[model samples]
Target: MRTRITTIAATVMLTAAAIAHAGNVGISAGDYYSPTLATTLTAQGNSVHAVGWYNDNVLSTYDVYIQDGSSFADAAALDRFVYHGGTLIQLPWSFTNIAYTADTTVFSRRRRGTLEQLNPGIDVIAPDDWLLAGVTLPEAGTQTIGREIGNRFADGATPVLEWEDGTALLGYRRYGAGLVVGFDVHLVTADASPLSADWSNRIIGNAISPVPELSTWAMLATGATMLLLRRRRPD
Candidate 1:
């Protein structure tokens, strides 16, 4: 009887761990892949795969898909995937404007040195959002100009993180039944500073990690209580 109780307890713990870490993520830049990003996601406890192309079948396999600034021909397939409840994370490349609603000239300026581009300070526009939870904005990264989003955002989109000057660094919105998240910095690069990399990793981890629902917590509590009760009942 004691052995059976122990087995149940072990099973409960394993189940909880699985629920907390189980997320299938795909990292892609169309034909270009980021090994650093893949390894980072793997370290964060998610099953990460490299996506070579964008299609309905490929997109459907992942709960979260990351587009690391590559241009692809199959835009419609990606749209359908998001429409049918697949989360998409976009990391725009150098000299491109993403998620901006208005003027693009603010991000078009060229930088001559790393010092001119790497800005570590960030402005938190959405402090209460779960994506920014437990993360300090000013410490997030040394995001470069033209590598992050501009201040203006599309309708219904929420900017969670931004440059000190108010240009968006990260943002998200709901599209159909899924979510679309945009990160302006190049997180996949090995060139980022240690502090910046740590912060970027933390945010990406938050994006891919699953939070257990209230019902799941209740069920686990009930099961554990029953097990304890059985173990203590005049045995």
Candidate 2:
């Protein structure tokens, strides 16, 4: 039987870093691969911004907001933009206040959590959710993606990927025309990793671009997988 957990308010252990600071950790010099990730977004044709927290105009201009801060001079403006139809990708503890807010209307609900390490576990994507197109999940259990959050679920929120512990590694919630996606996996921590770099690229790419499906591509993928598995199996 599969065990699933709902968002609950209680006591739990948090990551040393998270506990040390419940504040926004914006893109810094240490986030070595962040620039590469940004480059990928641009290559995939996304209008990426570093998110000017004080400027309301910035929020309205971009379709996707990559928040690296918590306090905003015009937070209401940002919320309104997302409330209407703007995609907000909240990175791990980027906006600490918003990240732990109990408001189900937004993404973060729980104020506490523990770290979960999954080595490219099974990632389930909903049919027709094209933001994650052309992205291949990790099949080999070598490299790991760390999600430093516990179970977080709310009405109208869809689970993009679930960790082994049944917590949402990635999740989305409907606000209006736009949506909010919470990513707990700290993919931006390192600078150089072949598999993780490509994976993060596509994940953000889909978030920025439309991932409409191609019938031919789908068939080819299915056929290829079957053929590869069949060849590897014992006769």
- All candidates: TM-score: 0.66, 0.61
* Candidate 2 per-residue lDDT over residues 140-221, each given as its tens digit: 4645554445545566777777655555656677666766776655542344332245765567556555443466345544
Q: Of the candidates shown, which would achieve the greatest TM-score relative to the real structure?
A: 1
Minimal lDDT window, size 10, model 2: 1-10
Native-to-model Cα distance after best TM-score fit, residue 100 in candidate 1, in Å: 12
Clashes of 1: 0
User: What is candidate 1's lDDT per residue for 124-217, written digit by digit as tens?
Assistant: 7877776765675535344443354343455567778776765666777776787777666653335642223666667777767645555776
Clashes of each: 0, 1
**Model 2 lDDT, residue 1, Cα:** 7
**Per the 3 Å backbone cut-off, how many clashing residue pairs does candidate 2 have?**
1
